[model samples]
Target chain A: MSSEVRRIRYSPPWGDASIIGVAGSSGSGKTSLALAIVASLNLPWVVIMSMDSFYKPLNAEQSAIAFRNEYDFDSPEAIDFDILVDRLRDIKQGRVAEIPIYSFEKHNRIEKTTSIYSPHVLILEGIFALHDQRVLDLLDLKIFAEADADLCLSRRLVRDVKERGRDIEGCIKQWFGYVKPNFYKYVSPQREIADVIIPRGIENTVAISMVSGQIQKTLAHKSAQHQEQLQRLGKIAEDAPLSPNAIILPQTNQVKGIHTLLMDPKTSTEEYIFYFDRLVTLLVEKAVDFLPSHPEQVITPAGNVYMGLKTSVGTSAVVILRGGSAFETGLRRTIPDCRTGRILIQTNYRTGEPELHYRALPKNIAEDGLVLLLDPQMSSGGAALMAVRVLVDHGVPEDRIVFVTYLAGPVGVNRVLSVFPEVRVVVARMGDDMEERWVESRYLGC
Target chain B: MTDNTAPSQSVGPEYLPIGRKPTATVSTNLAHDNVTILPQTSQLIALLTMIRDKNTGRADFIFHSNRIIRLLVEEGLNHLPVVEHTITTPVGRTYSGVKFEGKICGVSIMRAGESMEQALRECCRSVRIGKILIQRDEETSKPKLYYDKLPEDIAERWVLLLDPMLATGGSALMAVEVLKSRGVPEDHILFLNLIASPEGAKNFAERFPKVRVVTAFVDMGLDEKNYIVPGLGDFGDRFYTM
Candidate 1:
């Protein structure tokens, strides 16, 4: 049998300055194709930057036109290409950038945003990504995912109807009058610059696979470079003495006593319960001492009340459900009827990301109070760091969080501290020598 | 035989709650070995047969699950080292063997986890079993906790954590997190499951080496969903009689 001619899949840049531009007309499946490539290559460091996220905030005039479907959305000027260029540059340099949120319905940028931090493979996709000279210069590899004009228009029509909540009349008018001409003038011209063209976009699984294979090679190259840089950073972090920011709980005789009680094999269940309750009380007490407090006074039963300052325990309540709920005993015993909220961070093994299963926090978690993040064990500290980051991103001050865990390994503690050094952490005991793994192996003596 | 290096135990009753003033007495020396992890003959027989049978329905699947849970829980409780106690009999004579030190609670990882609750309650009287719902992602097959409600002072009680199936061990691990976050000491928790896969059990053991897993049967493999191979179909679906 004669060998088939293999397509040349576009390769991402090897060095740090390289950018990968995903460009195609609307509904060409550029985003879908990019995602497949990113995943197949296990390119966790890659950031998929949607050009839609950089859409300019609509001015009042444009807002009115947007409402009336008279705005020129398909034009390159509609996007904030300058900001997109800056973000791509920042990410390439290993700097974090706040990626804008694009609201499809209001047809403008949203107030909320997601930050892209230190991504190596920047999958910059949008209709106009390849149109701008500044962006084009930065891109090491250019891709054009193409589809038939009729097919693109039909797909866009359906997407707008289902996701964008647009009527067929508006979609047809927008596509025929504005989008059609813009594609020919702006998006189609970029085809000459593309190192690789994906025909039929996502439908051509073979093409996607080839591109993905290239991405893997690119990631492997970049990973070696990154690992070297990481080694340098680790040496730097090691040479620099532990920051005062890491507040270690005092390892005292009482602490060792408790640890001994916990570690003891012959300790009766009754003794176990007693020591555990006592230890938890102490741990909670110590954790509260770390909470931000302000001076306040309380009246006594006698005529004269004691003049003592109360800790400025922010008005926000504690929130822990699922595993978090177990702390209520100590919290109630110490804080006495403290208001509480719940957030469910469940792991979906398939995705390996802790999905927010449920969230019912107080209306003003960010504004009102200091949050005491309580958990029993922290191995990887991924969930804890993410939870704390979520609160901070939503406006909670870094200093307002007091994280307490019953047991913490060195790796998880280091991970949490490295990410959020400002947050106070207290653990009854620290297992300094440990490695965190997700899969559990059982004993099946052969 | 198993590794029998029991954790050190404190002699007297010591009660302290971290971050809070003491409320009730807490005896801390609850050794991990206190929870007996025995190989159950009947449950293993059931598990092997169920996994072997191609035509096993939801009902039979659930029955086997309950059977496995009951035997595992029994084994776990047997390992709970008890203190000697004596009470006056009608004949004015006293006798003593052993008595549990404190309250016990069952925290079930939801859905399939809830299936283990009955077996736990049957073994421990007035046991408070909490619920933590961790759903697996359709794409990743990882366990994600969707909802959870737990006891006030889980740290003070002996917690029997029940989840019928542990595949990749993601859900079980996260369930441990929920407990840890709530201040349950690593040794305070006992993870019980009807079936486990080698990959999952190995991963979990490496992360929390001190914690123990008492499983009825260790399956040989995991499918894409991380479901135990030759494993009965989704325990949650089957246990719910879906």
Candidate 2:
């Protein structure tokens, strides 16, 4: 959510930003090690997420107990793990996440939130950083800072007294009764889960440098792979071949008339909307014919048996936001009973890759007889590909998905077909010229 | 009525031969009028292609099969009884609508039938479900009922019997018998399948004239081994990797 955090505009199918989790007992220098790694790596984009920020807000009774130093902060129950897992997933998907700020003095979460954008590297540091299995699975690397119990206790004693305004006796009593016991019971066991254990915490310069070096190497390799993938995608778009699975509408006079109206630069927005609706309606009508039907025997008004075609099953439509939304009216006009679903996909201005922002599909979409994926235009096919991926992930068959778009460039169409060969692509027009306008728009930053 | 005598054959579970080449041709006498073969739409054809392709992975096979099954279920729902109801629209106009009349229950013929359970549940939230496991004896290929579990009020509900394939109609006939024994009227039952052969469809209709048959495709006649020709191999093996 922080505008300062660089938004990764591009996402290769294979590479993702690395996440390193640093876990240790309190005062074991977990935060220090996290800071050193970010500084040593010299990465332009890095984020340090302190697990303390995820503490569950305490109620009046709990706050009173915490004020009296009777509450155990180190317990795993003290954290809002559900929110932590959600934030971790959001970050992994290259989305901004709002992290809560905890007030140790009040023993509750403060009103404000820190907006964090996806970072090149994320370091999660806290006592339970490696505690939850779901959180552990998301971590690319886990480091447990190990220090002598006596040393940890001594450090906690000094820090709490100086910074937290705690008396020497209260700090010592809490350390032994609450902190030390929880450290052994909960924190120390996580050492087994760590990929690397650093002894003496940040003072161990050798261990710190080694960990930072490994991160640097991984980042370099991933970025290189990402660059190669981008090149491959560009090449695929350049050598765009007509996919055998694509259905291109014939350039009939009626179709041509609408195309001219849409293509004309001087056309009014109202006229464009009208023609676009007509064009989409025509496309959707044709696409519905592709849905299964059965022969039905009906008694006609003349008292004769009539054989007619009846739709076999229910159909659903999922429209990509904005451009794809233009086809919703057409879809309804064609199949009034069809349920509609919406998916919002936006191109990260910086990454130039489509990122899913919101999705609200009808319940039982998985059981829909057929799904029509609507996107009005396709130049790079990034959004279409992402939309198809979402559908497939939701258990919709690749073949059951029919992508209905008004205009499709060979590059985008081929890119989609290459990954999902069985998916049916229906377009009003498919030609080399489709990319021209898109390219000009990109150049103008439109 | 056809002869009710059961074939005398017993075979172990592991010895059950699936996708076996037929050794002797069997005659089929199904009434085509009682069966409905859905028209092959482009989307249906594409889905079938993915399902029939030998190289399709298990995950993909199941995914496509589920989609096809949902369509089949929707088609079956059209036959259910409905009553007209009136409602006021947002524009302040009264609109007459139809709603399903009776309670619905899904009775799956395990284990291939289990694949369609998710689709049926998605269609109707309050629908009850039952299961019947009827495995074929390896030697006779006759369906033998081993387990049957039905809801208490199944007699009053419209039952949708789910099975992915109708190769010989032996299991389907047996499933219908099981439902009939539970007091469910033959007219109240709808048999849904992904694919069925002409011979299998004929056998099922002959056995239960009142039970409706809905399937995606009616393939060519069954072979000597009773497997539907141009069939997509053994559905259970492909779907469950058994």
Candidate 3:
């Protein structure tokens, strides 16, 4: 085994920096050094993406070369720079991406993929993360971890022989013929472009500490920016009209009866279900009022029925499950033909905060269709707000989302309205006052 | 053939185990081996460092414990079968890598276990999540199930049961029992925590050796009141600021 290198520890975990890239020659201890930095930072949102994850599939010509050991896998031409740029962009925007998993034993790509979700700190570590201009554009900090060519070769020799199932003679031959020359020609030339370069790779404790401190300072700055956005959301009033397209349902006495049953602390579970379903039916009916209507007539047994209203656009009800799912039963009762989609959003009871659990919506939801965002209750409105945000991000128009809740307190209604003014709020009842925590009694009951 | 006591002659420095692939391909599999299971005392030190400091507010306490719990779970998962895989990129490219052994799910004990969700999310993205809320029955002091939502494919996945503090292990036991009823294999279950009492660990060890316990700290004896001594107060209360 190659002698163990000294471990360098970075102070203060990697802060909320957008991009941090690691670059080095073929066997320069880049992986080991990058891992040390990631471990020391201990940032949960950090994603260590490898440039090897972007290797180009072999063509007939390249496959023949690979078989003959004639292909230069270390060359920059070996990677897919477009996809690398795309993945980096997705990471920066805090979205999800399907990262490729590679295999060298068979010299082909594998079937299984890893889903990398929103990372707060993105650690792009690979040979070409810094070499390619397109890839480097996405990096906020560029680090080049360099080691002695002979030392790296020895580590590679041990690693290949013991771990990779390679023969000693073949490993040495490949290291000398292809790997070393590629490093000098393609990888080493990019060193001058790096913001920071370290000798002895991870063995340099001083370098690692300096990098860690810089990461912490960057993260502290980001946390402040996030706080500011949340503060702005706090200032926006809950009940304000979200947008001109908002379709507020008219309150009626039958609705009041349902609300009474829902709001009463003395209500039994049976009574709660009954009123909840009744309100759901009413909310579904009111949501239908927002869709485009076409002229139609109903036939009666005794005589021809007069012309009446019918929906023009196909309607789809997407329930944010389990609470919103309860509304599905009522939606079916009102419109038996309506298609249903489920999005699970659960509340962290302690923080009273909501998180997206699961979501499976229709592919064409954004294509001129009416979507009912049904929830049994909305309090603090975070889940409902996020649910709407998800749909919006997925291309569903804000006006297309009609939020129908059985009951909503002032706080939740205000939250949804403020975040998405164009979203319609239809409910059996809306409470006036919010508790100290901003949750209404009716919402709490649900 | 080499003598029995001799360092082998066949395994040389360049003895590649399989093919002409680079050593970097296999280096990743052994990266996390430096894992050390901190003793119960060390865990207490780590926890007390966070909770005892006047600077450690309710938010920071919950945050740091969550961080510690995530590491514990990741360490446990390291022992799983993560075979090397290859995948095609969206641009029709190929990449080689290693992935988790199987599908994973989280079953949290209501209240306390729920606080650990953010950390779990940070660790595994797009993980199919489930919940089992069982509170101690005030009258009987036995666990009473209030709510549960698990994926249909939960039986096929390894389940991680999360609870911040395990004192008597009653709630955790009940949760495991419930998951088994749902068809989760006993061996497929891993119980994770920020701190655990010996009584709970012993209870778990005796009841199901098949189930692994991944905890940051296994504290000394439980208090007369059944609280983990040097515990970070009532986890749920502290988490919710009650």
Q: Which has the greatest TM-score?
A: 3
The residue-by-residue lDDT of candidate 1 on B1-242, one tens digit each, is 12212221111101212333212111112224422333322214423344334355666656555645665775565444455544432223333324456667889887778877776664454688898988778888666779989999888877888887777888888989999999888877778876666677778777887677787655545656445554556667666855
Better of 1 and 3 by TM-score: 3
Q: Model 2 off-target regions past 4 Å?
A: A1-17, A25-126, A131-138, A143-179, A185-227, A233-241, A293-313, A336-340, A348-352, A355-360, A433-446, B1-242
For model 1, how does the per-residue alpha-carbon lDDT over A341-424 read when each residue is reduced to its tens digit?
A: 776665447633443445555656777546777765565555666566556645678767777776666656655555566666
Query: What lDDT tens digits, residue by residue, belong to model 2 across residues A233-255?
Result: 65665675576668887555445
Q: TM-score for model 3?
A: 0.51
Per-model C-alpha lDDT, please? 0.62, 0.72, 0.64
lDDT by residue (B94-134, candidate 2, tens digit) is 43444457888999998889889876764454578899999
DockQ for each candidate? 0.01, 0.02, 0.01
**Residues A276-352 of candidate 3: C-alpha lDDT, one tens digit per residue:** 65556556755665564333333322122222233356778788877666676668754677777788766656644
Instruction: List ranges where model 3 is wrong by over 4 Å.
Output: A1-17, A27-44, A94-117, A147-173, A196-220, A234-249, A288-368, A374-383, A409-421, A432-446, B1-242
Error of 3 at A31 (Å): 4.3
Per-prediction TM-score, chain B alone: 0.75, 0.84, 0.75
Question: TM-scores across all candidates?
Answer: 0.48, 0.44, 0.51
Q: Distance (Å) between predicted and true CA of A386, model 2?
A: 2.2
